[model samples]
Target: MTKERVLRFGRAQHLIGVAGLPAAPAPTGSVGIIVLNAGMVYRVGPFRLHVEITRRLNACGYPTLRFDLSTLGDSGASNESQSRAQQIRADVADAMSLLASHAGCTRFVLLGLCSGAQNAHIVAVDEPRVAGAIFLDGYAYRTLGFHLRHYLPRLHSAALWHRFISRKLQAAANQRGDDVFAVSFPPRDQVRRELTDMLDRGLRLHFIYSGGVTRYFNHPRQFRECFGRLASRPEISACQFEGTDHTYALQVDRQRLLQEVEGWLQRNFPTSDGSTA
Candidate 1:
């Protein structure tokens, strides 16, 4: 594992990372993958998620760079007043640029969790170098609404997210007014449509889902439909894993999950799949 305190856009200090590649020649020049971590600021729990996943991915013979999006972790924007959209997009572009400058990673395979996935989709849509993307327990699918749709029952039994949402809704009501919450953000459903429509051409997308989520929120069928709508030559797919919740990487089924991603790497970035490029 190699950690670099590099300067991304705006001279923000970033703990850029590369972990889990064996002590062998790792595809000289360009890198095979760039793994993204989601929502680091929202909760510290995601820290464990990013770290563990990077460890597993590296152990599985995949070298990865787990970066902090602007203002979220290490990379702070040029001006503090950067919008979320600008910050997120800049962070991603900075990552891709870093890959080229440091590792000779001409193109990157983007992987992000939840909001990170959303940002990755944003980056991939514009940059053609992004070959593929993996949404790990992602929430921005047009099929599923924003944030906690997968937690609703009609899709999966009211397991985790429903209760979490209920509490959040109550908290919002307690703190502010209906109009405030309603108008404060974009409807989650819109996020999906906008995201899919923004996809890059021929970008192979892999949605790895577990948490028993179905149509009511973010179901497998819904994801497929959304992907179908957005991608002209989209290689989109959905798969299910049993007994897992939204934060699948934390208590996420480790063995099977790793295999799923490993297989995905083989099909997508084969040279990074414990084999010679």
Candidate 2:
């Protein structure tokens, strides 16, 4: 059994979080896990992904915290004079500090989805205490392979071509912007450099993509194609669940994701000397 408690921390107690404590003491060198808010979603994550993840990790003798960034979910607004990115980084750092004090954790593993995943990457790069990061539906960029795979099939279908042409004409007539969420990723070069640095420092990074972002990422090997030799490094790993959307809306998809996460943690962040929890 695991115990969970609400925590209020950060400057002026602006941050709110729920920490899942393991029934037993965490093993030596165990890394605490933090689940950040997903996009504009609350700390519980899309469909309560954060809550489920925290419970699983806690059951495995790992302390897990699911927290809201300042001004999101149940957390209050921050008075810090900083950019949004800086504020997020500071919020995560504060979460780590709170986990350290409450659970005696020295190392940490950060996990997030979509926008939250991007935040995890940023924090992992600068925060030395972060031993690993799991990014779900994270940064992606188009490659030549992506173009070939994405467009080649449609080329043979006359109906597809007509629809495409019609859409193009409609778009030109409307002159309207795309109905997409305004999410920005650092330049590919910057991401490559940062990932290279993280790998050099022995940081464990896992990038998981879902079918929801197929426009930017499609195949399993797309990550390697985007980063070249940097992706082949031992510490870096990636996978894609083609059947699932960005949010894992279906119960089956969520279960599959949970299993994958549990397996990754067991393989990479074992609880004991030779066995995992």
Candidate 3:
């Protein structure tokens, strides 16, 4: 059995959160999980993925917390004038402290999607308490293979050819102007360095990409390409759902996503006392 409860605690501000706990007391050293927001969608996650994940994890004897950031969902705004990155790190740290005080959990795993994934990565790099992290539809950089596969198929489509020509002419017309299509992603070298340091510290990382990000990540090998040899480290795992959308909107896709994550957690962070049967 699993029990759900609302939690409100923060330093210098109040944030809203929900905790899922097993009916029986968790064993000593049991790891808890924290799910971050995906953009502004609140802590419920896209399609309520966070809710399902927390409940399932609790049933398996691992406590879980899904919380809303300041001004998002049920959380109130903070008066601190900290940068977004600083505020996220502080909020996550506060969540970890709350779990430690309330549940006796010292170790934690962080999970997130999209922008939340970026924050998870940032925190995991600096926070030693994070034992594992799962990033869904997170950072991605284009590789040569992606470009080839992406444009090769479009070559056969007349509509694509017309659009391409129009875009080329538009680019020529705006050669001296700033690029309007530019998008922001973390620098590749910095991400690689941080991933390397995290892995060296024995951190477990799992990355899952969906078809929703095909424009940036089209194949399973792109992660390796972007991160270089670090992607092949045994502590790191990557998966690509070429058919599923970012949110796993389809019932079957969502189930598959859940199974993949649960299997990963069981393998990497097994129960210390074999209590999760």
Candidate 4:
């Protein structure tokens, strides 16, 4: 049976997350890793699709935690404007510490979409718990671009969104992470520099973009070129999917995106080694 359990929980004023335990138990003596979503969405993007893989990873003896960084999901404050990229990194750091101290997961594995993944690299290098990482369809941090997902219907299932917001809002009175996306702002090259520096450290990474969303990047070719700039280091792995956009249109289909990251994760982990690092 596919099941999800909340281990220890915390918040970011807009974002909040639970140390997660999948239905299947992890193998004995193996540690767990956490998955952080991009843009403060729910823990159901590429993170959800690969639940089974992670379950198997855990069953084979590695546990995993999938959660929201801050204003993206249930992690932080709503009106608080927590989307500042810096804050998101802070939230991820908090989650990593929580995972290591409370949940006993010293080894952290992180994956982020677009800006989330970009932020993941920052956190991975800043904190030692992160051993491996995956950047699902990441792009170079830009100052301006068509943020379709901001207005489009790509944020995963909407059925429970209202309810979740209602409940979380009552508890905190205001949210933190949502505001990051509420207002669009100019990009800071320094953030890009920080992220580039992190990539140089050889963080195991996988960048996957869907085909459908390829047009947004002026077609996949240009997207890849810009992506290459962000990941300018030699030790990174990247790919493009056939039918996804900024939010990853078919990301959850049959583990579409997860398959790409499998190699990177394994290479980082002596166990999940694929064609990476």
Q: List per-prediction Cα lDDT, in the order shown.
A: 0.56, 0.86, 0.84, 0.53
> What are the runs in model 4 whose C-alpha is more than 4 Å off?
1-4, 11-32, 46-60, 76-83, 141-192, 216-224, 227-233, 245-252, 272-277
Could you give candidate 1's per-residue lDDT for residues 1-277 as a string of tens digits?
A: 4443334432454434443343443564334566665555431225365556556655544555666665556554456566777766666676666656554556577877655666676677667677778876655334435234443443565655676678679867787442211112246566556455434355577877666333233445555455455533436666766567555544537567767877876766666544532
Maximum-TM-score candidate:
2
Off by over 4 Å in 2: 158-181
lDDT of 4 at 46: 43
Number of the top lDDT candidate: 2
Error of 1 at 222 (Å): 3.3
User: What's model 1's lDDT at 259?
Assistant: 73
Against the true structure, what is every candidate's RMSD? 6.1, 2.9, 4.5, 10.4
**Model 2, backbone clash pairs (residues 3+ apart or across chains), number:** 0
Worst lDDT run of 10 residues, candidate 3, spans 177-186
In candidate 1, position 98 carries an lDDT of 60
Candidate 3, backbone clash total: 0
Tens digits of per-residue lDDT for model 4, 1-277: 3344554444434445554453444333234566666554566644355354455444433456667655455554434544566676667676666655554555667766665666666676576556666765554432123344322443675754675577568748756555432323235456455556556664555566655333344233443344446644555656666545455445374366555555455555643332111
Model 3 per-residue lDDT tens digits across residues 1-277: 7778898988965799998877766567667899999877888888888898888888778888899977778998778999988888888999988877767788899998887788899899899899989999877789898899889989789998897789679869989855422336778888888989989988899999988778789899888888888887899989998889878888898888888888888888888765451
Candidate 2 per-residue lDDT over residues 72-180, each given as its tens digit:
9999988978998789888988998888877778889999998888889989888889999999988879999999987998979999789778967986897656533
